[model samples]
Target: MTESLRWIKSSYSDNGGQCIEWAPEHANTHGAVPVRDSKNPQGPALLFPAPQWSHFVEYARKQSV
Candidate 1:
């Protein structure tokens, strides 16, 4: 799982300390989504299947910030 994984943070992320990081490479090849904190790259990542990730993004989009 450590090999061939390329992680990147959301472009909207700023130094204000709120950010989201994702492993797009893993998602493309394995159909599983990986999310983690920008502040803790070595921390545990939250893995979600493709469908679940889609639903989660949709739900989040509908909420007011």
Candidate 2:
């Protein structure tokens, strides 16, 4: 099921050892964002409501500023 989702890494990920990937398509189609560690593609994923995911992204962006 996960293989069917289009997962993308954060643009800010600089080939770092630690990275996170998210599926925006899933969010749009399922009303929930799927997030997972890039290093553990086969591991469990965390699902966040679209609005909550948006807030999390906005918060993360601000933290990097």
lDDT per model, in order? Answer: 0.80, 0.90
Q: Clashing pairs in model 1?
A: none
Local distance difference test, candidate 2 = 0.90
How many backbone clashes does every candidate have? 0, 0
Model 2 lowest lDDT segment of ten? 9-18
Cα displacement (Å) at residue 52, model 1: 0.5
- RMSD (CA, Å), candidate 2 to true, equals 0.8
**lDDT (Cα, tens digit) per residue for candidate 2, span 1-65:** 68888899988799776998999889998899999999999998999999998998899999988
- Candidate 1, which segments miss by more than 4 Å at Cα? 2-4
TM-score of each: 0.79, 0.93
* Residues 1-65 of candidate 1: C-alpha lDDT, one tens digit per residue: 63356888766567677886888888888999988887887778889998899898789778936
Using lDDT as the measure, which candidate wins? 2
Q: How far does residue 25 in candidate 2 sit from its true spot (Å)? A: 0.7
